[model samples]
Each structure stands twice: as structure tokens, then as C-alpha cells.
Target: MANNNVSAICSCCSEMDGIFSRLLILTSSITRRLIEFFEDILLRDVNRLLRDSEINSYGQSQTSATYASSSRDCNSDTSIAFLDRNASDLDDHHSLTNSGLEIVNRNYHRGVRFIFKGLMLPLYCFEFAWGSVIASWRCSCYHMRCMQANMQSFVSRIVKTLHGSSDDIGWLQSAPGMAPVEDGSARFVELLQGIRNGLHKLPDSFVYLLIPGLFSNLGPLYFVSTKRFFSKMGLACHIAKIHSEASVEQNAWELKQYIEELYWGSGKRVMLLGHSKGGVDAAAALSIYSEELRDKVAGLALVQSPYGGTPIASDILREGQVADKETRRIMEFLICKLIKGDIRALEDLTYEKRKEFVGAHKLPENIPIISFHSEASVAPGVIATLSHIAHAELPWLPQFPGEDRENDDFALAARKVPVVFPVSAAMALSALHLQLRYGEKSDGLVTCRDAEVPGSIVVKPERKLDHSWMVYSSWKKDPEDSSEVDACEMCEALLTMLVELGEERSN
Candidate 1:
């Protein structure tokens, strides 16, 4: 009985061993197959990239040959140089011939033969390492080519749109350029000086509406200072309470309704002043519902607005750009999932969407428009500048109904903490990118060219102001300047210019 039990135990152990061996074999097989699958994919991609490179090189070689032929015609020494170069290349190739193999075979001792055979292992290892590097290089080249092609195509389309072609007349040619943009910088500077002296005050004939830009919802203080400044002058000033993260069309509709409500309540035309994406939204409102809004809105001043399109948006969201899909996914997640905002809010700003939207809806020629754009300083000192984003209100301790709230020591607990960030650094980086890549001047967000609305009076400020500088106050104030010209004064100057333009149009 004991012997039989021991044998059963041994048989069970043997069964477990067999199962483990089978599992190991299965895992090895799967791993080998996976490696082979990846190897095949790598080879395919590398080959495709190589073929593309070859095609491009062939064209370049043909061009070079033609040039060389022409040069040879001019001087026979050129042909001799070319021939000598080709001969040297041939000599280099011949250097890698079977001379080594012949030497090994000549000294074919048993030990030498074994050593030669053993060298195959290290040779294969070297081949694998070198192949991996080549594969990576080729893959990088492939993606680079794709990115270049995408950029070229995008640029070509933009160029075509800028310069009218036979098939499609450029939009820029027929769009707002028909009216011609007036240089109002000199006049703007004078008005700004008058504003600083508190001379050119806005008339009470219109209700001023300040529309905030993207992420305005998060920063409750956005346009708050500007509104307060306007209010101090006893002017009917209000910030348009619309979701800044909403699509341009959606915001446009909201803005239209808001303008109508303001007009009906106050019995006055709304003077719309918008910053960044807000400007785009306001313009869309006027364009889409021109018949309705033309009578309600007095004028529009787009401050640092990308009315045409932003290259930053185009590059990130553009198809076929390097890591385009990945970048879009990241942006979508951040905008939609994290911020609870629509992706279309950002997508609408892209070149493709802007082109389509602008083509469909044109801004009314009657409304006085002012395009304001500034270049941000890319100096290292600017990076240290801080921007006031919002205030964090801390929770206070609850008191009884009859308790004196003013005397409570915990009243100070609910004190608002100023939230600040180094937004200038980000702006400087973006401005640097735009400057380096496109040789375009930008306010760290919108390029000067893109901000200029063709039909409007363009205000190109000499002062180096960033995108955030127009709306948010900077922590560091220049003490050297005796006259401190704030955002309020700048805004007043813009509106003053708009008023003049309106009178000019009327005359």
C-alpha cells in the first residue's frame, strides 16, 4: 500500500513537470513569433523609406548630372574631376572585397577554421546592432519626409490662397483687401497719448461690451479690471458672459443674443471689443447675422486676434505632421476631458477651419473694424515676468445666524490669495518658435500678419506686449516711466480710433 502511494505521488510530480515544460515551449514560441512579426514590420518600413530616399536621390542625381554636363561644356577639367571622384568611390568599394576570406582560407588550420566559424556569432550580433540603428534612422527620415510634405502642402495651399491661381482665385485678393487696410498706428499713438491725458473719453452713445478670450471662464478676473476702468468713467460697460471654450459659431450665437439683450435693455448700440479668441467669436457673430447685428453693433476692435489663423494651431492639428495624431489626442483630452470644454473650440482656430469659416461668412463692410497686433519681446528678462490669472478664495468658518461677521477673527480666513503664473516665459518660447520657423512677428500667440484684418484699421504697436499683456496685468511694472499707460488706456485708445473710423465712414 505504501509503495503504491509513493508511485502515485511520483506520477503526479512528473505530470506537473510535463505541464511546466509545455508552458515554457508555448511562451518561447509566442515570443519568437512576436519578434519575427516586429522584424517584418521594421524591414517593411525601412525598405519603403529607402525606396523613397532612392527616388529623391535619383532626381537630385539627374539634376546634378545636367549641371555637371553644362559645367563640363564650359571646362573639360570639370569632367575629369567628376570621373576621378567616381573612380575613387569604385576603389573604396573594391577595398571590401573577398581578400580577408582568401587570407583565412590560405591559413586553414583546424584552430583557425574554428576561430573563423566562431566569428560568425559576433558578426551576426554586430549586424543586428547596426541594423537597429539603420532602421531607426530610416524610420526617422520617413516621418521627417512626411512632416515636410505636409508642411509644403499646407504652405502651398496658403500661398495659392494668398496669390490667386487660374483654378482658384486667392481669397486674400477678393476678401477684405477690396476695402484696403489703413495705417492707423500714428493716429492710434496720438489717441493713446490723449487717452493717457484723459482727454479722449468714450461717448455715452454706445454700450461697451468687453469679450474675454479662451480659458476666460477659469480666470474670473479676465477683463474685470478693464470693465472697472470703463465703469469708473460712468460709461455702460459690461463683459459678455459667454463660454470662452465654446466653438466660434456657438459663441457667436450667444454673443448675438447677448448684444441684442444689451441693446434692447439700454436702447444703445453695442461697441464690441474682444481679445484673442473672443475677437474671432465677435467677428463671426457679425458675419453670420450681419443683417440683424449690423444695426446693433457700433464697432469691433480685435486686440491681438488671430482672425486669419494661427500657425501654432495649424502645426499641432495639421494632418500628416510629425506626431500630429498624438498631439491632437493630447489636446482633445486636455480640452474636452480635463477642462470640460469642446475640442471644436480649438479646432475652429486651425487654418483649415478658419479658411472654411471665413469663406462662408464675411464680416460686414459697414461695421468699423480695428485690428490690433503686438510683438512680444523674446528677451530672457521677459521670461521672469509673471501674470495674474485668478484669485483663490479660501473657505471661511461657518458662524451662527446672530453672530457678528465683521468681528469674527476667522473672517480673515476667507482672504483671497492671488494666483500667478509665469505666462511670459511660455509666450517668449512660442514667439521664438514663430520667429525662427516663419520669420513672423507675434504677440507670443497671434502673428502680426494673421491678426491684421485686411479691411480694418491695423494698429501695430511698437511696444513689446505679449498675448496675456493685453488682458492680464503683469507683476513687474516699469518704474522708469513717469506716465504709466495701463491696459485700460490702450483699450480706450483702440475704441477712440474705432470711433474716428466710424465717423470717417459716415462722411
Candidate 2:
């Protein structure tokens, strides 16, 4: 009886050993297959990205070739100026064609890629947990190391392909052949002081065109107060009515026509002072239509303009960037479907687009250009400030069928309300991000480096002012606001400096 019991115990022990062996084998096989599958996926994705990069490279090469051919054609033509205009139009079309669908498709794929990664998150976690266990038992970290190496390589490749070659990715830095930036801070101060003392006034010989930036159409009060202030000072100031969300070239054409009309009507040269993207649009107008606008325009003041490029636009729109597709999709929906604006309106401000555009069309050296940029304070108090973005008038309610007769007048009156925004908080957050990530100083949207236009007088103000500070009124009063350096006085100073620069250049 004892021998039989011992035999049963031995048999049970053998059976358990076999079961454990099979389980080990199964787990090992599953782990190996998962590793292989993930690596294969990584390989395929990398290959696809490479192919896309090559395709984009080919497209850019073709564009350059076309531009060269057009230049040659223009040079050969007897009517060079007219042909130059035609060539510029062709270049605009090419730019639209190249960037439009390609950008959309890349963004869609990026969003899809994000969804895919989220869906596979569980699998990824499981694999990592299992991988660690396998590594412990086998005492070999080779498989995990290999997977990590591949992942790092994959990420590096994506960044490389997205930004192009290392040499081509210097959009944040000043471009080669760009004119050196000159400090106009001292002169600007003098001018500001002069304005405050009523010693300096903007010349009445020119029609001051105050061009507002992106989405300015929605904000009826944008630059309205400034215009009123200018009017009070007996200046012929007018706010441009162009669609702020239109493409740079499109707006430029409209601006050119506007400048011509202003010049023809008043027999006075138009002095343009554009804020944010409006500055970019105004500069584009002068650059593209230099021949026609040489005598018609006196000067340009690009206040907080991203003349070079803005990293906000570039990072959001650049392919292979993390969350690039998701951000682009959101922007496209907002700008395209919701606002009925061109996506190119945002794209044109990107580092890549700005580099290309600025390279192709140089700003005419004849025009006196002033570039003004300031840093936004990211202090905690700034987050609490509110800004007026828009104004809305509620429709008057008709007194119908004897309803609430006593309060009818109160109820029926049209309600005028200001649309306020926490723009200061938004600016603070973005400024913090830029500072943390790139260590670059920005006015919430445009970095100091980006706003400094080549060959233009650059003014770096010590005052901490956000991008909207110039155009939008703040709910919270600035404690440091001096009696002399208000927005209107600052405008007067900039134009006065510009007028002096023009005179000096003419002499």
C-alpha cells in the first residue's frame, strides 16, 4: 500500500512538470511573435515615411525648377514687369497646389496614427509587462534592448523626415543673406517722448492705413479705438476692410489695389501700419507689387509680425511632428469649414512657407520698414486679465401680443455687449511653452527672432506686452501704464520714426 501511494505521488509530480514546460513554451512563442510583429510594423512605418519624404522632396525640386523656368521666361519677355506679375500668380498657384492636399492628407494620417496608438495601448502595456518577466527569467535583456533601439531609431527618423535635413531645418534662426538687424530702441524712445510732449506729430501728407491681423473681421472693435485716437489727432487714418483670414497673396493683391485707390483718391502716399499677420500681408503686398507701389506707399510698420516665421504654426502643421495631424485637423475645421477661411492663411506663416515666400520675393529696399516686437509677461497675475475680442449687438425683441407690457421697453431694447476673452491667460500659457521648450522669448505668438524683419529697423520694447495688447482692450488696467506711452502714442512714435527713416533714406 505504501509503494502504490508513492507511485501515484511520483506520477502526479511528472504530470505537473510537463504542464509547466508547455506553458513556458507557449509564453515564449507568444512573446517572440509579438516582438517580430512590432518590429515588422516599425519597419513598414519607417519605409512609408521615407517614401513620403522622397515624394515631398521631388515635389519641392519640381517647384524650384518651375520657378526658375518662370524667372527665365520673365527675364526674356519685353514686358518684364507684367510677366513678373504673371509669374508671381503662377507661383502662388503652385504653392497652393503643393501644400493644400498634401498638408490635409498628412494631418489625417497623423490623427489616424494617434487613434491607432491609443487602441494598441493595452497591447503595448501587456507586451512590456511580459517582456520584463521574460527578461528576468531568461536573464537576457537583449530582446527588450533591441525593441527600445528600434523605437528610438523610428522616432529619430520621423523627426528627420518631418523637418527635412538638418541644414534645412534652421527656420528658427535667421536665414542666410538676411540683412543685419539694427537696434532702433533709442530712437523709438525719443520718438515716444516727443509724442507725449506734443513735439512730434505724424505727417498729414500720407494716408495711414491700419491693417488688422487674423480674425480681425470678427472683432469689430479691433483697432477701432486706435483709429478714433488717430482721428482725434487730425490724422487721416483708416482701418483696412480686407478679409483677415484670406491667404497672404490674396490679401496682398487686395491691399495693393487699396493702396492704389487711396493714393489716387487722396493724392497722398499710403503709410501702412499692420499688426500681426496683417504686417505679413502688408509686407507681401509691397514685395510682390514693388513696381506699382514704389511711388504710392511711403513706409511700413510691422508691429509684432512674424516676418521670418512662427514656431506655433510650424510645429502644429509640420508633418511627423507629435500631434501634428490632430492639431492641423482642428485648425482646418476651424479655419476652413467653420470660419470659411483658407487654411493657407495659417500655413503661410509657417517657417517653411515663410522661408520659401521670403526667399522668392524680397521686400523692396526702397520702402522704410519698422519692426516692433515685445515680450509677454507670464506672471500669475497675467492669467487673470481679460481682453475684449469682439462686440455683438443682440437683436431687438418686438413687443408682441401684449406680453409683459410693464417691462416692454427694457426687454425690447437691443443689448450691446462686448465679447471678452481670457487672451492674457492663453498668451501666458503659450509664452511659457515657448520659453520652456525653445528658451525663446515671445509675445505669446511671435518670437522676438521671428518678428525681426531683415533690413528693417527693429524695436525691442522693455515693456511686457502680449500679442493682443496693441489691438484689443484689456479688462484689467495695467498698473504700470504711463500717461505718455499709451497705444495711440506708441503708434504715433513708430510712424514718426518711419517717416524720419524715409526722409533720411531719400536724402
Candidate 3:
């Protein structure tokens, strides 16, 4: 997997580009702040004489407070406001996730391939002498451990969701985390069969619109292959032809146009099933578009959608690489281009950006949203030996900052405004930026906390389900591959449920 070719694109080269861009933002921020600082000093000196003459004309302290309050308001509206991230909040050395991360970090060494670095001698020797067997062994060992500790739970929850007899699923809609997700595997299969029957027997009137994620139309390539798969099951599903790489607003507008232009039977409501960013974009469309369009939509099934945006978005914004180079190019070709030339798209996926969009728009009051989010990870893996550790030991990644709130007034005067906020190195970035709240449970993209959209029926976090696996390669052909989780069967079941829900709502 090492890109050692002399002319091939390098991750470090991308990293350097990211560093350069951040520096630009930092420079501009610094220049602006310095100008303001000098302006304040001059104004203070000039106002001293006036203050001395007037004696009680609006006390300086009071004026300062008024200005500060206004500045806070403006800052909240326009900028990303960060909660005080204490050092205590990080480095959860007591969990399996951390341990797994450490294992990966310790042995799976990254050799810099760029000739410009002029530092290939050591890694080359290691690769040539040992034939890279040591590195391979280290990676295999860690992956094995991840499987050993996590596979049973993963198979039970995710695997059982498909083939097992149990119906217990962690439901987020209510207080009870564990509830019946299905009657049984047999009943679910019957439901799947029923959906197929209905679709085969039904007329053109029955249409379920599938909206793909970021950088997609029809869905991701893997998702696209499943297109005729849903149709054969008896539902007339059409992929919403949306510009997958556009901002949510842009995508929404396009969707609004598509929905409005559609020819539907009298009183026929359309079913919308959006995956990943498509779900968020669909919500945005319904939120901002006309009520007429809202009336046409039956219900939305958001599958593994990031309604609150992923922390990875922040990582990409501060870093130059987007999903690595090859995957990035595939995304570009498949979805009208992704992050290489389009940084704004990445910016739009940041937590702050999503928050702004959600806050500004109102979710329609009547339409039902059936949202399912799945994340599989354990936090504090660094110290998994500590059995007493509670899942909540690490706070949830701050999605809208509800439970991890700091006092708004905490050391307000002493806080230094950051001219250039720092970003962590990308090597173990996920391990470091993980949310303690969800116990670092993520789909390799969105945290479960962030995925849970308020005022919707939600499936509580499902283990063994990573971001890519949810839509692409849920089950590995080889058991040796630690990353795979059997998600395809579970996903098909969810779609059947959505079709059933849509049928009920449409009628």
C-alpha cells in the first residue's frame, strides 16, 4: 500500500499543501487582529481626554462590556465557536480503542517516499532486509486484537440483525436502549419478500427516491450496483439525480426542483431514502423549500446520515488530503468531483457549518423522519484492562456542545482569541479526535451522537458498522480483514422497513 513511486502523488505533499493553506488563513487572521489591536490602543488614548473632561460620561468598563457582548454575538453568528477543550478531556489511556490505536501507531510505521524529503535510507533498509514482514506482522496482530475484543459484540448486534433470531436492537427514540428492532429474522425476510411482491405487482405510482451521499448520484459505486437490487425487490426506486459535490443549499435547491418537476398521481406521496450527505441535503431541501414540496414527500429514511456533520470534515478542512488520493479521485469521477479542487464542500461539512444550517432552517413539523445511524468503536482502548471503566468516561464528541458544556463565563477575560487554531497530525487523528461520550463509536466518519437527528425515530448506534462499510463492503470475503462488518443484510432489512413505512404513510 505504500506509494513509493518517484512521480506518484504523496500524502506528505498533500499535508504540505494543507499546511500552506492554513498558514494563509492564519496570516490573514493575525493581520486583521493586529490592526484591530492598534486601533483600540489609539482610540483609548484619544478617549482619555474626553473621559477626564466628562467624568461620568458612560464609564469605560461599561462601554467595554457592551462592545464585548456585541462582538460575542457577531462571532457566534459568523464564526466557529469552540468550547474550552481541557487537556484532561483527551488521552483516554484506559480503553480498548486507544490500545488498538497505540498498537497501530507503534508498529505500522509510515515510510516517507518522496525523494524531496531525502530520508528514505532507513525505511528502505527495513523494507529490503526484512521484506516488510515485521510491519505486516505488527498490522496483522493489532487487527486480530480488534477482532478478538470487538467481533463477538459486532456479530451479535450487526450480524444478528440479519441472520439471528433475536429482535433486540438499541433504539435511540426512547429511554430504553435495547428494544425489539424486528419480530424475527423470519418475519423480516417475509417483509423483504412482501416489498418485492408489492413492487413487482404495483404500477408506476409507487416510487421511492434514493438520494446518494456526498460526491454521488444514484449512490456510491457500491450503492449504485444495488440500485436494480432494490427494484427487483418490488419497489420502483429511482436515484435522485443531484450534484453530489455541491453544498447542502445548492443540492437542496436542485432536489427541490427535481421534486417539484416530478409527475405524480393524485394524492400520491413520494418516499425519500437518502444515504450519508444526501440525507442531510434532503432535510435541508425540505426545510427551506416550499410546503407544497413537503406535502409531496411521504417520509424520509436517513440511513447512516451525518445530520450534525462529521468531525472528519474539520480534519479535511485543516488538512489537505480528502479521504486519501485514490479514493478521492474515485469520488471525483463518480460524483462530479470531491475535495481535491473543492475545499468549500469540505468546509460545508464541518460541525459549525451544519449547526448554522440547522439553526437557520426549521424542520417541517408534520413530516415523519425515520433516521438510522450506525457506528462501531470503543474508546480508551489504551487501557482496556481497566474493567471498571464506564462507557461515558470519555465525553461525547462535542456535537452542538450540549452535555459537555462549559460555563459561558469561565475565565472570559483571560482567554486568548486564537489567530490560528491548531490541528492535530493526521497519523492518529481519529484516535485523538474521538468522542469519549459515544465511547469513540464512529463509522470512520460520523459519531453516533452527531448522527442522531432530533425529533426523529432513530436506531441507536450499531457496532461493527464503519462509514464505508455501511454503504460499501459491509461484509468482508475474508474473515482476516478486521474492518468489515456484515451490514448489507441489515441495510436491506432497513430498506424494507422504510418501504413498509412509506406504504403506510402514502396511504
Report every candidate's CA lDDT.
0.77, 0.79, 0.53
RMSD each, Å:
32.1, 36.6, 40.4
Cα lDDT for residue 277, candidate 2: 98
Off by over 4 Å in 2: 1-154, 157-174, 386-419, 473-484
User: Sort by TM-score, best first: what order?
Assistant: 2, 1, 3
Q: Which candidate's lDDT is highest?
A: 2
TM-score, cand. 1 vs. native: 0.61
- Candidates ranked, most accurate by lDDT first: 2, 1, 3
Cα lDDT tens digits, model 2, 1-507, are 544554565566556656756766786678667755765676577557756865686577667656766667645554455557656866676577557547755675576567656766776676677656544633433454556567776787577545532233235344678787689999999888877767856878889999999988876678876787788678899999899999999999999999999999999999999999999999999999999999999999999998887878777787765666788899999999998999999999988888899989999999999999999999877776644343444546455676664455544333435677667789988899888867788999898888988888989887888898788543334566664256767888899998999999999
Error of 1 at 435 (Å): 0.4
Looking at model 3, residue 70 earns an lDDT score of 69
Predicted model with the maximum TM-score: 2
Model 1 per-residue lDDT at 480: 85
Worst 10 residues of 1 by lDDT: 162-171
**Regarding lDDT, does 1 or 3 come out ahead?**
1
TM-score of every model versus the real structure: 0.61, 0.62, 0.44
